[model samples]
Structures are given as C-alpha cells and as structure tokens.
Target: MIRLDVSRIKNVPGETLRLDLNFPMDPVQSQHGQVSFNSPLRLTGFLTNEGGKLKLTGCLEGEARIACGRCLDLFDLPLKAEMDEVYCSECREGQGPGGEWVLFRGDVLDVTAEVAKAVLSALPMKLLCREDCRGLCQRCGTNLNREACRCSTDDVDPRMEVLRKLLKDGN
Candidate 1:
C-alpha cells in the first residue's frame, strides 16, 4: 500500500520527483504504548535519482502516546524525523559488504520500511512528560507534582539522628 512509482523516469538520469505519501502503521506498532492506539500513521517524503542509483529522502511527522519514565504519566509527544538513504534491490544483512547502487528497474518501490526505520531510530531512550516532572511517591503512590502527601518523613539514616535532634531543637 506504500509503494512508489518510478517507471516514468527510466531513461532520465537526473530526473526527480516530489511525492507525498500517507503511511499507515501496522497493528503491531501500537505495542509500544501503554494504551492501544489503532490509528493510521501519516508520513511524507520525496524520492530522487542521482548518478545511477535512486535515493529516498523524506520527513515523518506524527504524534504518539508513550508512558513517562518517571511519573508513569501517559502523554502525547510530537514525532518528527528526517532521513536520507539509498535504495537497493538486494540488501545485505550486515554492513561493510559494500552497498551496490540499485538501478531503477521496477515501476514502484515500497518505502514503508524505510519510513518506519527513520521513526524508530528517533525514539528517545527514556520518555518523559517534562524535564522537571516530580515522580510518584514510593510510600503512598501519590503524584508529588500534584500535592504533598501525609506519608511519614521519618525515613532517615540512623547515623544522622544526632543531626536530626539538633535541627529539631532549633540548635
């Protein structure tokens, strides 16, 4: 469903095209979220040919909901990614095999995986709603950012009792 047409530029070497593609993510991609998001994904990009090989360059813009690493809050984050890669008919499993320039042979090229790769690579290692988010309290499971809890604050090192008593007496 995400195929691109290229038969028109068979003989032309320097010819290029500006394509607007709408990519829908498979159901499997929704597993990344805490909740299910059964929405279709939209991605936009361009394809061009320079020298002998064809190149795919584009940007993906969308929104996805991910759980915050600290407060466990579910928030929507705007996703934007830019990528430039050469298209090859025969792809090697590993790098260093030397990528062979693929001649534009077919009428269409499926750019779904290419777009997916770009989006996946741009994901953050740790998702967060904001930088200064106060996480949930360990004792009462209260969101510290929202309100202060009545949980005991006596959980301190016994070695510092002398200092605690000194501070308590206003010494």
Candidate 2:
C-alpha cells in the first residue's frame, strides 16, 4: 500500500533526495508465513538524479518470520541490506557470482522495487525450527523429540564377528 512517488525529481539532473521508509509486513502477502505482522522494513538512503539516469544508495533493515533449520518452528529473522544501484533509460546488464543483476527501468524510480530487492537478496536459503531440534526418525517417521521409536540398535560388525567367535572358544 506504500507507493513511493518520485515524480517531482523526474528529468532533473543532479537532484538528490533522502528518504526513510517503514513498511509493515503483511503476512497475507508474504511469500510464506501465517497472518502475523512483522517488524517494519526500514529504508534509509538517497537517490541522485543524473539527467537520463538515477542512482540509489541506501541500507534496508527489517525483521521477518522464518522457520528454524532443524526444528521447523517459526522465528524472527533479522535483515540488514545495503544496496548501491544506478537506473537508466537503457538497461544495464551485469553478472556476478550468482548471476546477472538487472537494473531498474527508466525515468521514474520505483522505491518499492528497491526495498523488495534488498530484502529478498538478504534472505537465507534455508530456515530452521531450532538449533537443537531432534528431527524425525528415518524408520518410523516419528518425530524424535515428541516420541521414541522401536528401531533396532543391535548393529553387528561383520569383519570382527569371526574374531569374537574365536575369543569365545579360546582359540
């Protein structure tokens, strides 16, 4: 619902503006998570007008719900993101370790896009429930933390069985 309006700076060369944004997380629109509100996404930065281009340099910070890697329990993930980008009428394509980054489109800069990019890039690949969670059992599919399983523990070593038998016969 927060739409950043930069129409005033359009086509103004060397114009600069500093802004702060606090966006509340709406779980209903979140990629994944229940309807729980999260900490506001704080964006503090400046945009520079460069005639036919715009440059944005800023840091974005916020908190969102994330599942624990081991336990699957939902928790809060702190996000701190820093971005430096240049927007132009002509798209600039560049590559990095992961892949290429596409610069934002022309004259009017969309602040919402800048914030979303920062947040998404900073998110973790995997979410864990807890650090010390006992995962589900492989044989019975029972959650090890909640219940115990009747799995076999009589593991035998094939190479040492002959020696074990010889020792029993005093050979």
Best by TM-score: 1
TM-score of each: 0.65, 0.60
lDDT of 1 by residue, 1-171 (tens): 467787765346677888776656542243255422245556556676666456777787777667777777878777778867776543443432365333334677776666666667666876778877767766688887788876536676766766655653441
lDDT of 2: 0.62
* Candidate 2 per-residue C-alpha lDDT over 52-163 given as tens digits, one digit per residue, 9 for 90 to 100: 4667788888776765545455677788889876665454465432333435553445556556656667766655455456655545666666777665233647666566
Deviating ranges (above 4 Å) for candidate 2? 25-37, 89-108, 139-171
Clashing residue pairs in candidate 2, if any? 67-128, 68-127, 68-128, 68-129, 69-127, 69-128, 69-129, 72-129, 73-129
**lDDT by candidate, in order shown:** 0.63, 0.62
**RMSD, each candidate, Å?**
7.0, 9.3
* Cα displacement (Å) at residue 58, model 1: 1.4
What 10-residue stretch in candidate 2 is worst by lDDT?
28-37
